[model samples]
Target chain A: MAIVTPGKRPGERVANSKVLGKRFTRAKKVGHASLMLTSLVDMFSIIVIFLLMNFSANGEILYMTKDIKLPSAQHGGQLERAPVISVSADSVTFDGKQIATTEDLQKGDVLNVPELEDVLREERRRYEQIHVNDPEHPFKGLVNVQADRKIPFKVIKRVMFSCNQSGFGNISFAALAKTAGEGKPLAAN
Target chain B: MAGAAAQPAGKGGKKALDAELNLVPFIDLLSCCIAFLLITAVWTQIAGLQVASSGGPPDQQQKLENTIDVKLMLTDKGYALTMAGANIDIPKISRDGAQNFDRKTLSEKLKTLKASLPEQGSITVQPEDAVAYEDLVNAVDTCMGEQLRNVTVAPMN
Candidate 1:
C-alpha cells in the first residue's frame, strides 16, 4: 500500500529525492565490515612498551643449563666476554666441552687439576696466537667461572688453582644479579 | 571541532573537515615490535664478581706490601677475621638454621678495620675444603660490601 503526501515547502521534494538516491547507493557497500581496533591497539601498545623496557641490548653468552644453579649476589659487575668454565654438580665443562668429572676433582689431593690446566694452557696459547700482532688488546688472562652454589669449596679451590697456574689469573665468578623483591638466599649456604 | 569557519546551514553547508585515521597498519607495526622485543628480552641479569687471582704471573706483585693483610677464613662455624696479629670470630646465630651472623659481629669487625686502616683495600678469603661454595661467595661479597674490593680466593693455610 502507498500513501501520497504533498510537500509543505518548495524544495522539500528535491531534498527527499536526493536522500533516496544516496540510500540506494549505500546499499551496495553493506558487505564490508569495519573492525573496532581501538582496544586491540591499546593492548598491543602497552605490550610493546613493557617489552621495550625489559629488552637487553647486549645478549648473554652463557647458556644456563638445568644442572647448574648460580648464586645470587647483591653486588655484581658486568660480565665481559671471556672463556667460560662451568662447574655443575656432576661434571666440569670448558666452554661447551667436558673437561673432567666431579669425582676426579674432588678426590685428587693436588692443588691444581692437571686436565683443567692443560685445557687452560691450550686456550691461553690460542688467545695469544690470535692477538700476536695486535699490541693494544693483549691477552689479559680473564676467565669467567660458572659454578653451582652447593658445590664444595675444595673443588672451587682446585679450579682456581688450575686457572692461576695456567696464567688465567683474572677470574670472574658468574652469578645472578639480585633484585629487591626476591628474598635473600640462605645466608650461610 | 572546527569553530572559526562555521558551516552556513545543513542543506548546502561546507564539506566535513573530519578525516579517518586508519589503525590497521599501526596495530600491525605495534604487533611486530612487541614480538621482536619479547624475543630479545632478558628475564634475569647474569653478572660477574671479579677477583684477580693473587700469585698470578708474578708481575701483579711488587705492590705496597706494608699495608695490613686482612685474611678472612670461612669454615662451617662462621667467619674469622684475622689481621695485624688479632683474630675476631663470628659464629652462627643460635637456633637460626639459615641465618648468618654477618650483621652481628663481622660487620662491626670489618667496619672497625676499615676505619682503623683506611689503606688496606684487599682481603684474602681462605675457605676450608668442607665449606660450601656459596659461603665463600657470600664471604667475598661481604668483604666487597665493606669496601674491600680486591678479593682473592685462597685455600685454607
Candidate 2:
C-alpha cells in the first residue's frame, strides 16, 4: 500500500549516520575527562591541620577598637578575658563605651575622674552580682586596659586609679607581642 | 554473555562505588574553615603585662612589704630611680641627643640594683605627661631584662 522513494531513503540514511557519528565523538570526550581530586584533597587537608594548631594555641580574645594602638612588648604572658578600659588619644572608653575624654581626665591635676569611677563601680557591682552564688569563684577584680601608644601615661594612671577604687586590684595592660629581633635594641639596652 | 560472566561480581562492583567520595563539597567546607582559622590566629599573639594596682594576695603582700619598693620616674631629663623606704635617688642622666632617657645607663644602673637586692622582684615606673609610650616601654623592657618581673606603671603628677 506504501511506495518508498529510492532518493529519499539514501538521504535519510546519510542524516542518521551524521547524528550517530556526533554522538560517538561526544561520548569519547566524556570518557577522557578526568578530575584531579586526590591532589586537591591532600592540599586542603594540610591547610586544615595548620589552622587547627593555631586555633588551639590562641589565648583570650579581646575586642579592641581601631582607635587604640597597643605598644609592642617582647616579654609578657597571655591576656585573660576581663573588662576592657580603652584609652585612646582623644577619648577614654570602658568596654567600647566612651566614659570621658583625655582633656577631661587631665583637667585641673585630677588623679581620678568621677565619670570613670562611676562606670567602674557599676561594672564591679554587676560582676559581683553575677558571681555571688558561686562561693568558690570570688570576684577576681581583674581589668584589661587597651591604651593608645601615643596617649600620655597621665590619662592611663587616672583610669587605673579609678579601677582600683572600684575594687579591681589586678590590672593588665594589653600590648602587641614583638617578634624576635624586631625590637632587640630596646630590650638589650 | 561471555564478557559479562568474565567480570568479577562482588569485588569489582564494590570497588568502583567505594572510590567515589563526593569530595567537592568536602573540599569547599575545608577551605572555608581554613580561612576563618587563619584570620583569628593573628588575635592570639596579643599579650598582657600584669600589674597589681592595689593590694595583692595576702602571701604576696607580706613578701612585697619586706622588700624595697623602687620607683622609676621617667622625665624629660632621664630616669629618677627612687627607693621608697631607703629614700635613695639616682640623679637623671640627661637625654642623649633627641633620645629622652639614657637607656644604656638606665640598664646598667638597674643591673647593679638587681645585683645588690636580689630579693627585689618588682618596680613601679612612673612616666610624666610628656613621656612617649615607646620610651616607657623601653624603660619597662630594661626593668624586665634586669629580672624585675613585676613592673607597675604610675603617672607622675
Give per-residue CA lDDT, model 1, range A1-189, as digits (tens).
Answer: 577565333355554686554443333557688776888888898898888888878777687899998887767788888999999999999998899988788996888888889999999999999999999999998999999988998888888989999999989988888754576543333
Stretches of candidate 1 off by over 4 Å are A1-34, A185-189, B1-19, B57-66, B94-104
Q: Which regions of candidate 2 deviate over 4 angstroms?
A: A1-33, A56-60, A187-189, B1-29, B35-41, B54-60, B64-66, B83-97, B100-105
Provide the TM-score of chain B versus the true chain B for each model in turn. 0.77, 0.60
Q: Per-residue lDDT of B1-157 in model 1, one digit per residue for the tens?
A: 3224533344556666654565666777898898788888888898788887767765653456556888989877878888989898888665355645463366568778889778768888888898876767777766777788888877886
Error of 1 at A97 (Å): 1.0
Candidate 2 chain A lDDT trough over 10 residues, lowest sum:
A21-30
Using TM-score as the measure, the top candidate is 1
Q: Which DockQ values do the candidates obtain, in the order shown?
A: 0.45, 0.38
Put down candidate 2 lDDT per residue, B24-122, tens digits, no spaces: 678788889888887766543786777776344334333554478789888866778887554334444433434445666777878888888888898
